[model samples]
Target: MRPLKSLVAASVLLSGCNGMPVAFTQDPVYDQAFVVHSGGPLPYMLMGTAVQWNEEYAVTVKHIPYVPGSVYQGQGDIQFFRHKANGVPLWRGYTPGEAVTAVGYNSLYMSVKGSGHALPAMVRLDAKEGNVLYGTHDGPVAKGMSGGPVFAADGKVVGITVAFLSSSELAALKRPDLASQSRVSIFLPYAEINREWGRYLAQAQPVTAAPTHLASR
Candidate 1:
């Protein structure tokens, strides 16, 4: 895996403030999976990765960012792209002020801090015109949320939840004396997975026998 620094450089180049807003006419191409630790079922979603796995089990590790204080109000959604194949869900669920890390393309990862819950939320917009694709409401980010998927209404993997900011960071951003800080969450582009799906599947070992045709997609 590439180091976080190297990954950030590439991500920055690929990251954009705009998204496409055309209504989705078809269901996502991949199936959604979860890596829950001990909860009934989370507001789970699906995501995809290019890295092949030794086993079919979901990738449960996560990287969170570092932030200072209570600037986030926890009221929005984080936007990201979905890989067409080998789609894996990136999990996001943290307190208003927490620190976490996330893995990215080129095997790079980064640490991020959350200011408030709202800061971690994403708003999918039109890639061409920058219009809203869809939005998710804010809710409590629980433990073991890492490695879970953030899904769209059509059940497509949009983005993964990385982490939240620390209390000090939030306070600093909210301070009247300081300029506003832009809140961010790290995510893997879904399209990237689509490009690398074969590579990942080749490396993945089935955890269980493939489900029956009716049971399986």
Candidate 2:
């Protein structure tokens, strides 16, 4: 997720935020959740977006503040437990030039209390590096949309919004042709996300040490 320029007070409420563009709209499905970081008692900062996978679990990108398999205390008393990173088989069913939706909340585009802005996008490419897959979309992804989901045409989640390629990143990747584009967003395909989920789960597991000394009877 893109970092905030400055941290606001925990008490600062979201006010006077801009609305979504005319081309974009709101959807209840992706409005399942919005993640935040505790600024303090008075104010908290909006981090990114998440989608409810089920009543008990939700899916989001790995960059948010909350850890996988942890409790996500939402606005008020509403709470949801972050889904654990799993070895669930990777999903690679998306096709190029397919219609998709990128949904998430941005401080710049606040619509409702608990919902995210939805942008119509097209699948530009889906590239595989090693065992990980990254999907590229021609969506105008903003700062707060980082952890949002990219929904396929049939309303199935295909990828998690990660970052948009910067000019330098494109250069490094040897993609000079994309330089003219205003913005091209990148997403972690479910496969790459699965890979990271497992990594995060492993990291979060506590280390169990062998007994330093045996108990003497």
TM per prediction: 0.28, 0.56
Off by over 4 Å in 1: 1-33, 36-57, 62-140, 167-186, 192-217
Candidate 2 deviation (Cα RMSD):
9.8
lDDT of 1 by residue, 52-115 (tens): 1213333322222111111111111221112233434442333222333222211121211111
Residue 70 error, candidate 2, Å: 3.3
Best by lDDT: 2
